[model samples]
Target: MSLVARIATLAQRDAITTTGIVLSGVWLFLVALFWLLAPGGEGTQGGIARLVVMVGTILPLVLIWLAVRTARAIAVLRAEAADLRQRLAQLRDTAAPRGAPRMAEPEPLAEPDRQPRAPAPVPVAPRPLSRPLAESRSPAAPAEGRALDPVDADTLILALNFPDGPDDSLAVSALRRALQDGDHARVLRAAQDVVTLLAGQDLYMDDLPPDPAPPAVWRRFAEGARGSAVAPLGGIHDAAALDIASSLLERDEIFRDTAHHFLRHFDAMLMRHLPDMDDAQIAVLAETRSARAFMLLGRIAGVFG
Candidate 1:
């Protein structure tokens, strides 16, 4: 399903759950109140007793139903978590340093006919995060492209790409480090929360008033990210850096939506133009990576039991 669709579904589920909880609470409270306030006559005793029994029997059943539904929701999240691990692996593979681009464009394909033919197909250009590679790197340690061990590679990646400004990265780093230090449940949960936040966002949530949508949620950001007004093609900003900072602060449920919105735009521009299609490098943290991060994110945010 599309990201937007999934978000809508989660919202619906939340609504249903919340309404059920409220209705059940009200019913139980009213029933209890009636039980205590019943007329103190022998004529009413038997009916009041029967009503208490019915409430007792039905309340447990309702609670059980709610528990089962919650469990199923968690199962869905687990599947998404696995997908994120695979995505991160794929992203790491793509980030492998490729040989420097060979200078000089290939000559136009020789045409047999003299008529004006189309120009040679252009290779998709990479839209590298405008800042230098060093700037985006986390400060704890630096390594010259190291080989990743399935177990430690993720932590290493976290250590390598830490964005210092947000607590999420540090929180994420702690989880990874804990994993490296042999804390499995903690690390796994943390990764899940990050993924959860990215894939689903809990915004102005069920109990809160709505936040108005921005007129151009991303317009100013997109404009400032690349190019000075005078030289759109030549200039670039640290917009990705800003994204790393801002989205981490967003509510965990909807973190994925916020980050992916920007990352997708980056991928479309850089990879969409390539000819072979398969050869272009896209840097979006998507597919499985997104799922993993959300799962971990949920855990860290204290939403996961």
Candidate 2:
């Protein structure tokens, strides 16, 4: 990006830092102009007054700039720390031992001679064919018989929550599985983008406790209901989280794009499974970290009015 575009992007991501930089530039320019135009003939007292005025004007601006820079540095560190932790966890999972090898079996010579004799065939019962889970559950599935696998669904849910720590082997395994899946991979990537953005702003889905809405409300959302009719689906009401998410959606281009992308995939997945899921399953899904992120972002996006 060009300098101007970079500045614009910075302004969108961190308005306070951009504003401070602009104000500092303008302040310094005005001070320089004043010093250059002012008469030079003055006593020691007059010189001291000028010095004091300059210091007074520059001090507060310097402090503001310092504070903004410090905040930016802290945010960067937090994001880096999170990235490092995730990388370490991934490394641990990758390096983990699979299992012990099986022992070799002894050769069977006498048994081979006995097996030469003809053996009677056993009757087997015919098994019934069934439709894909996705097709059986809802017509809203993206493809006719390409339902999301139950294992994939579980893995996606686990991935959305993210691994709590290096010890969370189950979540790590699920995340790996989700990434390997073609369809689930898209949703995982989108969710990761949004989650990372949210983390940059210090807004973790795990920290936001949303109001528990009924499964029927979630079902309505899955069925395409929006606005006030399904507003309850956006149960996250944390003021700080709402304000930050709302501001980002309105200003940050990257964040807005990822949030929208994540929303679309999540909604599609929900629609495909909600019809077939029981109330308990829906409730379990609603409690997931990804679902919470959805509620927060969906509310900010006005999907729930």
Candidate 3:
């Protein structure tokens, strides 16, 4: 690629360092050449000699700093790429079929010498309840037959971003640092890091040029109507739904924290599948999970429905 394209590509990850390093290299070369050719000393232009001396001394240091910064950014991207590759390999291994290993034949048991007496038969009482109390009190509706609405799906997509909300993650704090430093490259890289973390969990923003939500639903959402946000999000449990969920969480601190809690709690559930979690903690996590799912996929239109 051409220099511009190369710089642009690097800009996505470490634009400031990339540009600075290039400029510093050129400046260092020009300064060094001028000093060598002119021999900046007595009988030379005082201002030119002073400028050459200053540039000659500072450019190498600037170049070194830029090079180090670029190297560090490249290292971080490489690490993340390695991690992604590892996860993909793991998934592939899990999905791939494996052949059963061969086993040795077992020896047959010898027959008993004497006849053994049979135990007497005992009658057992039938169980009192056929089902659990929780199941009996609240029956779940059939989730498979329900269809997703276009508008609600769109709203779920829109909910993925919280442009005006504050972020709670360290990555966001780094993003702020990049912004304060006016480093577009670092800013974009930091933003990508945050987005990747969300995407790893299958959350995404559904908005693109064409807009995924129905026009009517979009209007209602844009107008901030109380009932326009309702959608049947409970049934949306796949990676695609995660995209929309992630987008919403990024845009809204409340949604982000809620999603964070849901993910961490669900992770805990997986780790503690043996039912070792406290009843209160389980109840809270379960309720949060259910509520978040409902809000994301439920069919009640409201301000935050």
Candidate 4:
């Protein structure tokens, strides 16, 4: 049998209850019609009419109760069907392979003459914060033929002081010696000494600690204020130095600013002494074996060939 026919048979249960209820409804209707149309006049006739009226009222109540039960059964069957459909959908979802995409509804076919359009381009996501510092480096430009400035020297000085100023004994000694000698030639020599010390450290510049400050700190540092924290060179006043160093070193900034001490003594000493030296003295200083720092500074300051 078809599904509808099967469900009808289940509700009827061999059709006995359904047939009895239908007969009962028709009987009660007929009896009511008779009583309304024909009124009995005498005592015996009135008693028989009252008996028929009582039977009609009782029959309808029983029929109504059976109808209510049948309706409840149909409602229960509908609920079960709905629950089964939901479970089936859930099972299908669970059974799908781990890597497989979920099945989507099929699209309607287009006109025969039309070709399929290309899919939309997917958006690219940005790199995460944890990406390697090396990958974040900007392309380095050619330094040759480019004129260096005091800013460049200043940036280099900041790079040297990253985390903290030059702690190298040799460079410190030279700086102190120049201060004591008070000679322009000796000051030139001292600048070269500092450069030589930095050059040696440059070999392992990659080994320095990472910049702990955020990009905002670097931005502010570029503006002239030191960073909010201690720098690798050990102070914030020259935070822009981080940018220059990162460019030269071709790495990301990753150093923390700590403590609260402030000093511009190194850059000050260079600025004060560099201007006193004549071109000839600077030239002499640049020619020395340890004169790399002096050459860099002199080129930046336009003081030496």
Kindly report which residue stretches of model 4 are placed more than 4 angstroms away from their true locations once superposed.
1-41, 45-51, 98-103, 110-305
- Rate residue 288 of model 1 by lDDT: 21
Cα RMSD to the true fold for all candidates: 21.0, 17.1, 22.7, 32.9
Question: In terms of lDDT, which candidate is stronger, 3 or 4?
Answer: 3
lDDT assessment of candidate 2: 0.63
User: Ranking by TM-score, best first?
Assistant: 2, 3, 1, 4
TM-score quality measure for candidate 1: 0.26
lDDT values, one for every candidate: 0.35, 0.63, 0.35, 0.34
Q: Please give the distance, in angstroms, between residue 84's alpha carbon in candidate 3 and its true position after superposition.
A: 2.4
Off by over 4 Å in 2: 1-152
Better of 1 and 4 by lDDT: 1
TM-score result, candidate 2: 0.51
How many clashes in each candidate?
Answer: 33, 0, 26, 20
lDDT of 2 by residue, 1-305 (tens): 33544454455449767777888888888878987998876556677887999787879788878888877766555555555556434433332221100111222222223342322221111111111101000012223443444443444555555555445565555655455456666776676556656766656666776788999998898888999999898899899999999998998666677789999998887887678766766776677667888999988888898
- After superposition of all CA atoms, the RMSD between model 3 and the true structure is 22.7
Candidate 3, position 126, lDDT: 16
